[model samples]
Target chain A: MNTDTSRREEHWQRTRKLMFITLTIWFIFSFVVHWFAAPLNAMAPDFFGWPFGFYMAAQGSEIIFVVTLFWFVRAQHAIDKDCGFTEED
Target chain B: MAIIKGDFIDNLPKVYLMYTGGFLGFVLLMAIFEQMGMGSDTIGILFVAFTIAIYAGIGWLSRTMAVDAYYVAGRQVPAVFNGMATAADWMSGASFVAMAGGIYFGGHGYLAFVVGWTGGYILVASLMAPYLRKFGCYTVPDFIGTRYGGNLPRFLGVVILAVASFTYVTAQINATGTIASRALQIPFEVGVWFGLSGILLCSMLGGMRAVTWTQVAQYIVLIIAYLVPVIWMSNKQGFGMIPQLVYGDAVQRITELELLHGMGTLDPVAGAKAGLKALSVPFAAAGDSWQFVTLVFCMMTGTASLPHILMRYFTTPSVKAARQSVAWSLLFIFFLYFTAPALATFTKLQILDPNLATGIIGKSIADVQALDWIQKWSNVGFLQIIDANADGILQLNEFFMRGDIVVLATPEIAGLPYVISGLVAAGGMAAAMSTADGLLLAIANALSHDLYYKIIDPKADTKHRLLVARGLLLVIGAGAAIVASMKLTSILGAVAWAFDFAASGLFVPIVLGIWWKRANRQGAIAAMIGGFGVGTWYLYMIKWGGMDIWFGINDLRFAIIGMPVSLFLMVVVSLMTEEPDAETQAMVDEIRIPTGETVLKAAH
Candidate 1:
C-alpha cells in the first residue's frame, strides 16, 4: 500500500514539473521570443544560413510545438506507467 | 443537455445522397457555364430558387424534427458521411478561393499554410476528439465548465470563442458579398445580403440536421464548382494543361500570373527593395523567414480550436468514431489539397510562362478588346496587370502581393465562362455561408445554452433555451454580417488568428483535462486564464496596440506563447491545490477509457 501510494505521489510530482517546463518553453517562445522579433531580425544569422528572427518565426516555434507535443505524450505515458494505467485497466 | 430522442430522425442517413432535381439543376448549369467560358452570377438566379424550395417545400415534409433532428442528425451519422460533412465544415471559401492564391502570390513561401491547416488535423484527431466525445456535452462551454466544475472558465472560453468566431464569420460574409457584387452586377455588399440570408435560413430552419445536410450538399457544389472550371479550362488549354488558348491567335496576351501576385497589400517601396520578385506583409516577410513558422503553428493549433470544427465532432457516435472520423477528414481533405498545389503550379505557369502568355495573346492575338470577362472584372477589382516598361510584354513578377484571388479568379482567367464563374461564386459563398453560420450558431448556442441556461438562469425551461438561442442568432448574425461588410483585413488572416487563440488557449486545457487523469479543476482554470489572457493581449497588440514594427511578427507566435503558458499554469495549479476526490478521479479514468470495462481508480 505504501509503495503504491509513493509511486502515485511520485508520478504526480513528475507531471507537475513537466507541465511547468513545457509551458515555460511555450511562454518564452510565444511572448519573449515573439516580443523580441525585431531585435532577433536585426541580429546576425545563427546556424543553417537562416536569419535569426526569420528562423525563430518560421521554424523555431514549430520545433518547440513539435517538441511540446511529443514531450507531453512521453511525460504523460511515464506517469501512466508509474500509476499502472494500462489501457487494459 | 443530451441529444433529444426521436424515432424517424434517429435512423436517417446523415450523409446519404441528396442529389435532387433542384440541386442537379445547379450542377448542370455549372457544367454548361464551364463549357461556355462564363462567370458565377447566374448561380444566384438559378440556385436561389432551389435553396428556397428545399427550405420551404422539402422542409415541410418533415414533421418529426426535434433538437435531435437539428443537432448531430440525432447522433446517427455514419463515420464516413460525418467525415464528408466535417470536411465541408473545415474547407471554407477562404481555403477554396484563396489557397491557390497563397501559392500564386507567395511562390514557395505560403505553402506552409497548405501544410499547416492539413497537419493540424493530426493533433485534433489525436488530442481532442475521442475525449471530448466521452464527456458528451451539447456545447464547448458545457464541456469546459463541467470539466472544471465552474462557470468562470466556461464564460472565459465563451468570450474567446465568440471573439474568434465573430472575426471569422465576418470574413465569410465578405466572401459572400464578393460573389454577389461580381455575379449580380451590384455592389459587393449586395452579395453579402444574399449570402447572409442563405446562412440565416439554413441555420434557423435545419439546426444541426439542416446545416449538416446543406453543408454536405454545399461541399459537393464547392468542389464540383471548383473542378468543373479547372478541368474545362484545362481541356481547352489541353488535358492536364492549364494555359487557355482561343481559336484566333488568342485575342489577348492574358497575364494571369501578374494578376495573382499584384492583388495583395503593397509594401512600402523601401520594403520592396528586395525587388519586384519579393513581398513582405502582416503575416509574412518580404524575403520569407519565420513568419510562416508561427502562422503554421497558429493554423495547426487553431484547427483544433476552431468552434465550428469542434462542433462537428460532437455529431459522432462514439469517442473512437470521432478519432477515426478525423483520420477520414484528413484523407478526404487530402484530395483537394493534393490538387491545389498542382493547380497553383499550373496557374502560375499558365500566367507567368512567357511561352504561353506571349504565344497565345502576345504574338498572334494582338489588339483585342471588349469582353466583361476581362474589362468588367478588372474594373470591379478582381484581376490586375502591369506592363512595367510599356513594351507590351506583361511582367509575371508584378503580382507578388495579391490576396486570395487565385481561387477567386481561376475560373474566369481559365475562360470557364460567366455561368461557371457564377457557380464558383455560389460555391465560395456556400463555403463561407456554411462555416460562418455554424460559427455564429455556436456563439449563440454558447450564450443560450451555457450563459443564459446554465450560468445565469440555471432552472430555465427547454422553450426558453431555444428562444434564447434563436434570439441570440438573429443579433449575432446581423452583427457579424455588418462586421463582414467592413472588409478591412484579409479573410484568411482573421481565420488564422482565431485558430491561434484556440491552439494556445483552449486546446491544451480541454484536451488535457479529459485525457490526463491528473488534470484538475485548478489546472483547467489556470490554463484557460493564462493562455486566453496572453493570447488576447498578443492579438490586441497587433490589432490595436500597434506593434507594427521592430518586435513585429505574425499573430501565430503570440498564440504559441499562450498555449505553453496555459499548459504550464494548469499543471502547477493542479499540483499546488488539493487532489481530486476518489469519485472525480474515477470519472477522469472513465472519461479517458470510456470502454466501461476498467475498474474505478482513486481520484486523488
Candidate 2:
C-alpha cells in the first residue's frame, strides 16, 4: 500500500478534532445510550416480537464498530499520507 | 537481505496429526453414546476427563525440561506454528466465551473487542515487532534497557509487564472456571483447579516448548468446540445454514409476539398473537451528547497496549517475520470472530422463547440434551423473561440479557451429543489455560530476562540465564495458580480493565520507539514509565476497589487521558535532552536495515 504523499494534509488539528467528534458519537450509541435505554425500554417494542433494546445492546455495537473502524482506518491513513509515511504494506 | 534467507519449517504435521487423532477419537466415542441418548451431565464429565487426559498426554510427549525448551520453544518455532500458538494465546477465556457474552449483554459496544483485538496486531507489526526483533532480546524490559541506556527504564518496563500480565491472567482463570462448572456440574472452584493444573503442567514442566504446542492444540480444540454447536445448530435447522436457522423464523415470530405482549394482547410466554410487529429504530440520540469518543479512543489505545499480544514478536526470527506474523494472526482470528454475530442472532432465535421447537427436541431420534440447564440458568437470571401477562409458556420478549451465557450456551443450542459437550468443555478450558500460562510465563521471563539476565548479571552466561528463567517460571506459575484458586469475574470483565490500562500506557511508547529517531533514552523511559503510571493511576482511581467516579463520570472513559499526557511528556522531554550517541544511532541504523546479514553482523 503506497502512501500517497501528494494527498494534501487536512488540518492536523482538524483530523484529531473529527476523530474526537466521531469517537464521541460512537460512545453515546454504545455505553451511554444502551445503559440508560435497557431499563427504560423494559418490555418495549417487539420487532418480529423481539425487544428493540435487546437487539441494539447485543447486535447493534457490531455495526457501529464496523463503521467506526472504517472511519478510523481511513482517517488515520489520510493523516499518514499527509504526514509523509504512506508506505502501508 | 532477509528476503532471500527466509525459510519455512514444517514440524506441525506431526503436531496436527496428533491433534486430529485426539479430536477424532473423542468425536467417535461421543457421537456413538450421544445418538444413544446419554444425559448432558455424563457427557459433561466426559468432557472434563478428556481434556485432562489430552493435556497431560501432550505434557508427557513433549517431555521438555530446561527453560529454553519451555520459554519461546528455545525461539526455534517455525513461523506458521508459532502464529498458531500466538493466536491461541491472544484468544484466551475472555475472547472465546466472554466476547460472545459481551455481545449478549452489551450488544454492539462490545464490537470493540473484535476490532481492538485484531487491530492491535497492525500496530504491533508496523510499529514495534520488527525493530524489537532486531534488538534480539528475551524480554520487553531488556529491549527498553538497551534502547534507553538505563536501569530506570528497564525497571519500569518490568513492573508494567507484571501488573498487566497478572491482572489479565485473573480473568482467564475466572472464565475457565465458569465454563468448567457449566459443563461438568462441578463447583466453580473445581473448574478453577482444572484450569490452574494445565498451566502448572505446561509452565512448570514443559516451559514454552510444551506451552507453545499445548497452546496450538488448545486453539484447535477451541475452534472446533465453538463451531460444533454452530454446525449442530445449522444442521438441526437442516442444510446447516446458520443465518437461516438463526434469523429465519425467529425475527417474524419474536416481533409479532413482542408487539402483542406490549399491546396487552399476546400471551406473556408465547408472545402476542396480533401480527408480529417489527421493532427497528436507529441509535441516533445526542446528549452532553453520548460518550462515543472515549470508548473508541480507549479501544484504539487498548489494542496497542496488551502484553500477551506484544510478546509474540519475541518468538519471530526477524522484524519482517514479526510483521508478517501479525497479519497471519488476524487472518486466523477472523475465522472465529466472523462467526460471532451470526452465533448471537441464531442463539437468540434458538432460545427466543421458553419452549423451542418441540419437534426438534422431542423428535423420536437419539441424543436428547436435557435443557433443564436452560431453565436452571434462566432461574439464576443468566436466562430470564417477563411472563408479561402470566401465560404458562414463555413469549419472545422473555429473552433475558446476560453477559456470560452465550459461549457456554452454544453447545446446548446446537443440541450436540454429551460427548461433544465434553469436547466443548475441554475447549473452553484450553482457552483459559493457554491464556493464563502465557501471561504467567511472561511475568516469569521478566524476572529472569530483565532482572537477572540484563541488570543483575551481565556476567551470567547462557546456562545460568536459562536456569534463572526456569526458576522464575516456577515461582510465577505457583503464584498465579494461587490466584486462579480464588476465582473472579468472567475472563472478559476482569481483563477489560487491563485492556484500558494497557491502551493508555503500553501502546504509545512502544509505537513511538520504532519510528522516532529523536526518541532518546530520557524520552523513551519517561514515556514508558509515565504512560504506564498515569494509565494505571487512572484505572486505579476509577476501576480499582470499585470506587470509579471521577468528576461524576465512570473511569473507563477517562483511562486514555493518560495517553496524551504520556505522549506530551515524551516529546517535551526528548526535545529537552541530548540526542542519542553515535553507538545508539548506529544500533538504530542496523535495526532499520532489512537484512539478515546485518543481524548476523550484530550477533558477531
Candidate 3:
C-alpha cells in the first residue's frame, strides 16, 4: 500500500515538472514575443517584407504555439505511458 | 479495431475532397456570372443564398432524436474534426472580419488579441480540457455542479455561463446582422431578426449534433473565403503567394510614409475613434505595458473559461482526443489568424499606394472624393474623409476609418471582381452564425440540463429535457436578437468584455477544482461571487461612474484584478472551512487520471 502511494506521488511530481517546463515555454512564446516585439522590429531588417519583431508577434508565435502544443501532447503522453497511467481503451 | 479506425481515417480525406470540389464548383459559377457583367447586388444575394443553403442542408441532415446525440453528437467525434468544429465555433465575426482591421489600425499593440486568444488554448489543453473530458460531463456548468456537489454552485454556474455566453452571442448576432444588411441590402434592425431565424433553424433542428457538423462545414467556407482575396491581394502586390512572410516590407513602407507625413510610427489610429488619445499613442508606448499585458491575460484566461468553447472538448471521444483536438484547433485557427496581420498590412498599402490613392501631391478634395471605392464605403459610414486641414489633396491622417472597413473593403480595395466580395461577405456570415449556434446551444443547455434536470427535477427523462432545452433556445435566441438590434457596442469591444467577465469569474474555481484538493463548495461559491462581483462592479464604475483607471488598470483589463482576488478568496475560505467530503476528493483524483471508462456522473 505504501509503495503504491509513493508511485502515485512520483507520477504526479513528474507530471507537475513537465507542466512547469511547457508552461514556461508557452509564456516566452506567447507573452515574451509580444513584449519585446517593437525592439526586435526596430533592430531587424524586413524579412519576407515583415519587420523581425512584427513577424514574430503576428505570425511566428502562432507557429510556435502549434509546435509547442504537439510537443506538450507528446511529452505528456510519454509520461503517462512511463508511469503506467495510460487510459485503457 | 485498428482496421476500422484506419478505414475511418482514410475516409476523411475523400470526404474533404468531395466537399471542397462541390464548393469550388459554386465559386466557378459565381465567377462565370461575374464574367457576364452581373451586378454586385445580384452577386451578394446569390452568395448569401448559396452559403445558407449549404449550412441549412448540413444542419437538416445531421438532425438527431436521442438526447446524447443532441447534446454532444453522441461523443463520437474524432479529434481532428472536433478541432475543426471548435475552430469554427471560436473564430467568430470578430476574428473573421475585424481582427485584421484591428491589427491594421492598432499595429503591434493589437497583437494582444492574437497572443491572448491562441495562448488560452494552452491552458485549455493542459489544465481544463482533458480533466473535464475525463469527468465525462456535457457542459462546463455540469462539471462545476458535479465537482462541487451542490445546487447553489450549479445554479451560480448557470448564471455565470448565461451572462458570459449571452454577451458573446449578442455580439455574434450583431455581426450577423451587419453582414446580412450589407450583403442582402436590408436594414440592420430587420436583418438581426433574419439572422436570428437562421441561427434558430440551425441549432433547433438538431442541437449540438447539427451545430457540430454545421460548424465543420462553416469552417471550410470561412477559410476558403478568407484566403482567396488575401492570396490574390498578396500576389497582385508583388508579395508572391507567401504573404505571411512578405508583408513586413509593407509595414516598413507604411512607417516611411508616416515619417514623411510627420505622424509618429506605430499604431497611429489605436483608440482614435474612442477619443482616448492617451491609448492612441504609438506601439509599446510608455507606462502601457501593464495594461497591454493585462489585456492579453484577460483574453487568454477568458478563452479557457468560456462555456461554449470548453463544451467543444466534451464532444471528443476521449481525454487524449480532447488534448489533441485543442492542438488541431490551434492549427486550424492559425491559418486565419496568421494571415490577418498580413491582410491588414497589405490593405494599408493598397489604401496608401500613390498609384491607387491618385490624388497626387497637390490634388483637390474633389479629386479624392471622386475615388469610387471611397465614395461607396464612406457612404456606408465605415470611412470618414475629413478635410481637416482644408487641403484638397488627401493626407494620410485625414483618412480615418473604422477598423471593420479594412476587411469589408478588402475585395473592393484590391479591385477584385464583385463575386469575390460576395464570397468574403458569405465567409463573415458563416463565422458569425457558426459561433452563434454553438453559443445558443450552450446557453439553452445550461438552463435545461444543469439548472432544470440536475437541480430542479432530477427525475426528468431525456425526452422532457430535450423539449425544455429546445424551448429555452428560442427564448434565449430571441432575447439576444433584441439586444443585438440595439447595436450597443462594437463586436470586438463586447467580445473583450465577455472574455474579461468569464476569466475573472470562472477561471479561479475551474482551475482550483482540478489542481487543489482543499477546494470546497464554500470556496467555489465565494470565489465566484468575489471575482465576478468585483470585476463586474469595476466595469460598471468605469462605464457609468465616469471613473478612468483603478490603480493603473482600466475596465477592459479588470480580469487582472478579479482573477487574483478570486484565487486568494478561494484558498482562504477553503482553509477556514471543512474540507470536501472524502468522496469528492476521490472524484477529483479520479478525474486527474486519464482512464477511458465512463466515470460515474455526479449524483445530485
Candidate 2 to native Cα RMSD, angstroms = 8.4
* Candidate whose TM-score is highest: 3
Per-residue C-alpha lDDT of model 1 across residues B523-578, encoded as one tens digit per residue: 88788888888877777877789767325455645687778888899888888998
In angstroms, give how far residue B194 of model 2 lies from its true place: 3.0
Among these predictions, the greatest lDDT belongs to 3
- Output per-candidate TM-scores for chain A, rounded to 2 decimals: 0.75, 0.63, 0.90
Which residue runs of candidate 2 sit more than 4 Å off their true CA positions? A1-89, B1-9, B36-39, B63-69, B242-293, B353-371, B378-401, B461-464, B544-553, B597-604
- lDDT score of residue B535 within candidate 3: 86
**Global lDDT of each model?**
0.62, 0.61, 0.82
Taking the tens digit of each residue's C-alpha lDDT, what string does model 2 give over B1-604? 2211124134466648766787878778877887888776887777766766777666666655454455555555655666778878888777777676665444444554554555455445545665676666666766667776778878877887787788788777777667777776777777766666667676666666667777777778888777767666756655355542244245445444335435234232444232221112111111122343355456556655666666676676555456556556665665566666456545654543335563221122122223555566655456544445444444334434455556776665555555665776777788888888788778887888778866788787766776777678767766665686675444555576676666655666666665566788888777777776776666666666566565543555555566787798789999999988888766765565334342322311
Clashes of each: 35, 41, 5
Worst 10 residues of 2 chain B by lDDT: B278-287
TM-score of the second chain for every model: 0.84, 0.84, 0.94
Specify the CAPRI tier of model 2: incorrect
Residues B1-604, model 3: lDDT tens digits: 2321335445765776788888889888989988999888999989987888878877776666687878887777889999999999999999998898888778777877887888889888888898888888888888888888889888888898888899999999999999999999999998899888888888897888889878888999999999989889889888899887667777878776545644553233332345222113232222245555677789999999999999999888788888899999999999999888888777777765665542222346687677777798768777666565665666655566777767878888778888899999999999999999999999999999898998889899877888999999999999999999999888888888889889888898899899998899999999999998888888888888887867777767888878888898999999999999999997887787776465554222
Flag regions of model 1 displaced more than 4 Å: A1-89, B1-26, B29-44, B47-65, B68-71, B237-289, B357-372, B398-402, B548-552, B596-604
Instruction: Pick out the ten consecutive residues of candidate 3 chain A with the lowest summed lDDT.
Output: A41-50
